[model samples]
Target: MIGEFAKRQGVKKVYGIVSDYQVGRDMWASLKADMESKGIAIAGIDFTPIGTKDYAILLDKAMKSGADGLALIVVGGDTVTSLKQGGDVGLASKMKVMGTMLMDETQGQSVGAGGALGVHSTLRYHFTQDTPRNKRFVAAYRAKYGELPSQYAGEAYDGMSWWLDVVESTGVWDKEKWVDAFRNSVRNDSVEGAKRMRACDNQAEQVGLFGTAVAGGAGQPPVTMKVTETFTAQDLFKPCQ
Candidate 1:
């Protein structure tokens, strides 16, 4: 979806910057292949160490390489640092910034107000998303915890809720039987909406949201993501689905 977004924005060249790790390498490889397949040129793929504090040289290299965008493939703290540095040096003006699994609400807050504008990322959930189901969940969660639930917290809550319900329905103490029940009985109605566990793999097949981070004012989270597209897990799974 990030690649698709770049194409939509007329970006023709991408420079991949990622953490020097297995996860980062794999993701960068996937992005590079996808972009190239779509006829978008990959100027280069560069790996930065986990604790990189200075992205000036890296950004300069990407700019000099003539990349129209920077494809970030790192998450958490490393992602935050690189994004802030990218913003600091006005990298966004030169090239689009985007990545996968990097720009969630917490990371957006870390990016601070107006810092992550035009930064695109893929996500499964966002607090600002407006839906009857999501609204109810957010209200209940904020009431209980005095704050909005992060995506991880929401996932954990949904998992427990589904498990308890499935177990109650099964009315069984047998471990094997319960596993089977869980595997088969996971057409769960979650805050994000209806989702079903793939019976073959027992992985919850949920919808994915692709979005771009936008600036939010004071008293709100540092940034908010505007959903640009949605895709089904089944559509992605293909043969498995």
Candidate 2:
């Protein structure tokens, strides 16, 4: 999706850097295949093992790849360390960077302002979502938990809401009725926006977001992820179930 996003931005080529885990390898492979179909060549690819520290060689190759964009497929502490090192080496100015498992507040703080600026990420939720339902949920969550809600919180709320609605309308929570209720309902007023559980796959079809990480001032987390695009349910690609 990041490659597709880059192509939409008119980027013709990109380098892919992923960690040496099976998950990272699979992600890069998928990206390479997708970009090829779109006429966007992957200029180069590399993998970093877990706990690997130095990125100077990888950064050098990335700068030399002549690609104007990058696909990063690493997670957790590696995400922070690599972004910081990539920034230190001027990779951000030289290329448009996109990645998985990013735009997190904790990672942003570790990456800092200079390191995180211009990094783009796609994610399921962000606490700063401006929709009215989201705003109310965030306010209530903060009041109760003394912290911003995560995607887990959103998932819990959506799950319970769906069941409650089902129980209210039918007054029978039998297996057949429960399944029917979920499949038939359209939850337009969800905190995350309009959603419908796909009858074919039983997955909630809702909006995903693309965001840029920016520095937040005092009293807030060190970094704040702000949404730039709201990808509708129909915009998501679903496979045969």
Q: Give, for candidate 1, the lowest lDDT window spanning 10 residues.
A: 232-241
- What's the CA RMSD of model 1 in angstroms? 2.5
lDDT of 1 at 106: 75
Off-target runs (Cα >4 Å) in candidate 1 are 7-10, 217-219
Q: Which segments of model 2 are wrong by more than 4 Å?
A: 163-185, 217-219, 238-241
Question: What tens-digit string does per-residue lDDT give for candidate 2 at 137-187?
Answer: 999999998888765687688678877887688887587887888887788
User: Could you estimate the TM-score for every candidate?
Assistant: 0.86, 0.85
Clash pairs, model 2 backbone: none
Q: What is the lDDT, from 0 to 100, of the residue 214 in candidate 1?
A: 75
lDDT of model 2, residue 212: 76
